[model samples]
Target: MTSDDSRSRRIGRRSYLRGSLVGLGTLSVTGVAVADESGNQCPAEEPDESEEREETEESNETEDQEEIEEQYETVVDVVEAGADPEGNESITPVLREVVGDDTLLEFPEGRYYMDEQLRVTGFENVGFVGRNATLVPATYHEFDGPQYRLFRLGTSDVPGRDLRFEGFEVDQTADETGIRVISVEVEDGLVVRNVTVRGVHDSGTWGPGLFNVTEPEGEGIVARFRAEDGAIHADETPNAGNMWRGATGIVVNPDHRGTLVFEDCSLGGFPDNGLYASNETGRVGVDGGRFQNSTTASVRLSGTTGRIRDATVVVDDDPHDSNGQHAIRLDGGDHELENVTVDVPQPNGDAIRIMNGVDSAAISSSELTVGDRPNSGIRIDPTAGATTLEDVAIDIDGSANAVRILGEDAEPVVLEDVRITGDATGTRNRHAIFCERSGCQFVGLDVEQVGGDSRRGLELRGSEYVVADSEFVTTHTPIVVNGGDDVTIEDTVGRSAGDGYSLRITSDSGAVGLAGNEFPDGVRDDR
Candidate 1:
């Protein structure tokens, strides 16, 4: 057995002992019941079922770890295999000759230089681990043809299984420097972690990383992979004629067919979109990352079913040759955004846009804060499917609608426990909830709009709507039913601080049902 296998076994034994001890302690505490002095029995202790379950779970986890460690039977140190460690010579030739299947390639405490891409394909159970190692790539002019990437692990047609690449720093701070550090296409069980790119990408090449899982049952994770300096525009680089808009931080394209998770990654202001994983057929998850100041969007995701949870997207600075910047954009999927925080202090577009053709979406327990610009906080496009906004809060400092729902023929939307508070100061009429869709339900809504006289609270323009248990406080009319059929406002409160009516119903409106609602400034029924 190899030293790595021995070490893994020892670690697994320790983990198992630790878990057993923890389970025993829990059992000792929960298996006994105690009473107070007054003879009132404490809550009856159930059987110690959780202790057994915990022990089983820990044991299974240890087994999985040991299995992974044992697969790398052969270990090769690249420096020992006729490769230079001082960054004076290219390691690409040695890597091409020494890389093999079921091997662990180690780089120990050195700087490796490469002027060409190192391509590997159709290998199983391969790993590249680094210890205090740095990789320096050739500048744009000196790199070989198709100067896009440093390492191409696998291709879609010839994918490797069970790959791991981690623990290295990429130094691209030299003049005219840029390269895609690694592009990995795997069939199953891929892990890429702790690879930090340290500099701005100025070579007008591809982005720092691209990853994909090419099989239906495959799973992959890219964690703590940071490129915080980001990239520049292509026109400013020596390779300007070959590329467009410079590089993006990371990309996952449409050929991906399995589940991929990006966890705790940080990306800076790239010229194009940051973490653009749209147009994929499988599931993609962005969990706990910070993506900031990309041109089109900081985090744009689309797939069959996916989510963006506990992530932060900020657009504090405008990109060069600035275009619209959406903090988070979701397209063509059944997705959810939970516990997300989007702060666009220099907003150029909507904070969160659910684009057309989305099957279904939900935004829950998220906070969106937009600056003093004329962009909407959340915009649901006209052709999107059903959506739900629950436990969400929007804070706007400009004349933007808190929630703009467009599509008159779209599916029903539900907004429950949502809060909108901010100043609407523009000349145009800005409503907190601007709904043009039919068959929508608004429940437990708290909306407050201040500043201009055109700042209304809720404008419902479609048919078959219900507004229940909502409170609206605004400068203009709080509730306006301009043209809608079978609209009901029950158990709600509408208050206007200005001279406008608290509730207004235009003459062209259809049948309206009002039950147990309070309009402090009175209602104007022109019908």
Candidate 2:
């Protein structure tokens, strides 16, 4: 049978079995049947490999969901526990009296106003479930916490474990200055879901995000949430002339360890970094999120083994166009970024800045487009260890370099199947890729029009380099090795515009070998 017909037959069989198993009470015990009641054994049925795999995965997922749901019991309603949802009274004592082990505090659809910071500490398996309920913080003068937080989950010294805070919105717009919405310092088993914080944060010494996972231990997840500061953009009313108040959307500090997952979350129009996961001893996973209009880096993650998958960072038309804003900053970790998209419309922005001390990084299937004069699409800083950028496309619209590797190191930095385009008219960009570190290999590179103001397609200034199977179409020069030793340029084809040479080597380069390179006028040692 054809593959399609076989797939259909398998699907139909699985569907029929699923429907039958729902009503077969006796057979449901084992999820599979064997014998008949007539004393005759039935033939053993061969299992469909794909069908069995999918079913096993789904069963495990359902078991996890069921286990989580069975842990917490809805015990008390905040309104019934002397909480005045009409925005008048203090619910601190009432909320304290209602919470217990494995208790879920249910807040109905109403706006709860708090003059003082609503604090919860040292509680296990305690949760907050709200249905369209909002916690509105009073003005900065009326609020009580010296920390200026709307909700404090756990203290710094004393941590709470097995906590869940979900389905609530915190309004910090009334106090225009920076104010943290939720500050969580938990030990283990924490979940923060579907929480929204609205306002421009401008109060704290170092601006805090809407949700701050300060010192989490073990496993925790923050999903389906939004933390936005509307005024940090171009058209909104500035906080005070320049309204960027160093606001972060979601931040995890360095004290956190173990696994912390952020899924389906969003952070927009913040002054500082958005969605920061920086822990020296932890592993962070950011899956499917959008970080936009950040003044500094959009997402900065530094962990033992960090991952950012299916994430998008946008720095388009930000009003306070700062020079040091990096769309995504990977610092101090062996991180893997997959299927990430970065769009930088501002001039002085870097799409991806991999800082020093990172053990390793792998970025695959990612696209970066920078407008105006952004710094670089991807920058591998000094002291960074082995890095691999594969199947990545970069487009620079202005005078910025597409990829830049700085400082000197002997760790292998590999670029495979990478396409970089500098598509500007009057002010063409610099080199499409600039390398200054040793031990690097470039394979399958497609470069176009990256030489403006006497730049090159690829500029190398370090030793032990390999450029093979690469195509370059540039304005001024194609490849230039200013200060490098043991450089090999093989299997490369390039065309330089105007009267500029295809390959130019300065006096500082040493021991350069050019073999199998299809250039117009061979290699010119300008030394």
TM-score, each model?
Answer: 0.88, 0.80
User: Mind giving the per-residue lDDT tens digits that candidate 2 earns over 279-330?
Assistant: 7767677766788876667788887777787788888757455557788998
Predicted model with the maximum lDDT: 1
Clashes of each: 0, 4
lDDT score, candidate 1, position 184: 92
Cα lDDT of model 1 by residue, 1-527, tens digit: 77676556434433433332222222122222223345354543343545544553464334343353455667788999987899999999999887887787888899999999999999977878777899999998999867899999999899887777878999999977789999999886677878999999999999999999888656677878999998899899887877768798999888787777787789998888899886558777776789999888889888776778778999889866676989988878788887899999889889999999688988999999988888899999999999999999999887878899999999989999999887765356468888999999999999888778568898989999999999998888899998887999999999987887888999999988999999889989999
Q: lDDT values of the candidates?
A: 0.82, 0.69
Error of 1 at 361 (Å): 0.6
Model 2 lDDT vs. the true structure? Answer: 0.69
User: Which candidate has the top score in TM-score?
Assistant: 1
Regions of candidate 1 where Cα sits further than 4 Å from its true position: 1-69
